[model samples]
Target: MELPEEHSLGAHRRVSEARHTISEILTRSQNEHFAKGNDLDFSYVSSEGGRFRVNVYRKDTGIGATFRSIPSEVPTLEKLALPPIVTKLCDFHQGMVLVTGSTGTGKSTTLAAMIDHLNQTRRLNIISLEDPIEFVHASKNSQVIQRELGTHIPSFAEGVRAAMREDPDVILVGELRDADTISMAMTAAETGHLVLGTLHTTSAVKTIDRVIDALPVEQREQTKSFLAQSLLAVVTQVLVRTPEGHGRRAICELLMMTKAIAKLIQTEQTHQIPSQLQMGRDLGMQLLDQALLAAITARTVDPDDAYTYALEKRAFQKYVTDTTMLSKLDSLAPAAPVPPTNSTD
Candidate 1:
């Protein structure tokens, strides 16, 4: 059900097809509550042998829906071009790790790979609560229980609360959408589970602020303290078109929650996170601009692609004027830092 983003279909045909698809998905969802709103979100397997997370809503023109394809076979981290350091995340017994980005930037894909890595290597119980389960995993060394919202569960907050009683070693909340859900996910981390979640923000600093802002003013400080203690890493990613124009390359900005970062979160000084990211290179943290520059120098991504998604345009422009500076930037030493350690779960 992967329709072209831009299509020449007539207005009437588009509306008709959209309604039909919505009806089909509703039939599969078997939830009587779908008629309560102007929009509905669900997942359905098409007759054409594709699994998709479907969203149907009322647009100005008429009814419209989007179908995001979910691959039947889960891909590996190396296949997705993720950094090797990502493998280290699986070793953490308990903490919160966030995979963040704008929509369609491969955030879910990255998380799926991480979960799959755990499935292959660890003998732990992994439970994922997704709005509509995508990239279904066949448990390997680990036991995975994936719950779909509206189908298998009521809400993410409820799902996480249920997971606590399920004796889960790892809990993956698809996205921290609201105050209640965020609170529950944080509590899950605080108690004794490794919680992996996603947010819509484009950078690690904003991700921290967004989580705090979602809560009430009175609860923000308490939430920050919880986050400072339980939070582990935040990976912000964006997909840029490859230089060959055949596929997309992911430019990742990784932020490992170190003692300094934890202190910043505890004090609600999130603005300093960008500075920490800049100097925390030895620990594998990098800014989006740095990742973009490295990709450009390596010819994995085009200059235009880098400029289009860069947070600072001037940063990339410097490489354009001075050709020899690329070597200096590439040869920069990584700062020495201790491996990440978290307090009691």
Candidate 2:
């Protein structure tokens, strides 16, 4: 039997009630009625001043809701324990820096941290477009203006276009969910404003492909050209159980755009992108597999969990102590990459 208890991002309490009772609580807390066949995304503040990101959606069993506890203060890159190199991505005056991960993986927190860093260090105009604003930023060094979708604008595309005309030096898009928004972000980057955005992808290569694939066949080639010029880096994150099993930690794959990598993108040789990441340690790029391998080597993360998410499964095969589990993982792993052609064209 499914329990009435639901987990919030940071909260661990179990609330026992009927499903309808839970829905009523949500409606009362947010004061928004989500009609049938429609969903609502918004933030709620507790009587204690705690904030949570809430989502209510239609489900087969009736209305389903999920809540993610938002930290009152945004953490810094150092606080998140992300690499020092991550700070360099934020330092770029103009270009696109993409933070990508699956849902519930803290992509929002990473972007918030970057914005927080800018808030503490830089003097510029920072504009954010969120579905429903989560963390609130008060201007310290950089000026911040946060906008919500339903409350402030109709869509992220409109907000982005409007941001361009508003004299923003940095624009934060909560998600590059569609082609138009992604295209607008690239355009903004090309026009000399640093654009920080998120994508729902697993690796750096897939992140690049997602942008190109989202476009029409007629627009893809040109979009690649724009992306090749405007993309500064792609940081893909995966959360894994920490060594103590009491919390989670981010395993990251950072793809820093370089001349050779950019050429590979232009030539559409994206399969070779992983090879570039392997050779890019001095340049601050790393594959998800590499990060997983390190985490495994340090005994900071379980080998079994790392293998489950690894793109190149062979890297962690020897590290996994459970033969039965290794076999189980192999069954679910995708087919390996095709060998590169040696013939000169």
Top candidate when judged by TM-score against the true structure:
2
Residue 168 in candidate 2, Cα distance off native in Å: 0.6
Q: Where does candidate 1 have its weakest 10-residue lDDT segment?
A: 1-10
State how far residue 229 of model 1 sits from its true place (Å): 1.4
Across residues 1-345, which tens digit of lDDT does each residue of candidate 1 receive?
Answer: 333333455755765675566676686444345555546666778899899887776544555567778889898988988877677887899989999999889888899999999999999999999977888899999999999987788999999999899999999999999999999999999988999999999999989999989999999889889878888889999999887889898889999988999898987778999999999889989999888988999888877767768877657865454455455445664667989888896
Estimate the lDDT of model 1: 0.84
Per-residue lDDT of candidate 2, residues 198-298 (tens digit): 99998899999999999889997888887788899999999888767777778899999888988898899998999999999998889888898988888
Model 2: per-residue Cα lDDT at residue 25: 50
Residue 277 lDDT, candidate 1, scale 0-100: 92
Assess each prediction's global lDDT (C-alpha) against the native.
Answer: 0.84, 0.85
Q: Residue 187 in model 2: shift from native, Å?
A: 1.4
Pairs of residues at least 3 apart in sequence or in different chains that clash in candidate 1:
282-335
The list of candidate 2 runs beyond 4 A from truth reads 1-33, 329-345
The deviation in Å at residue 67 for candidate 2 is 1.9
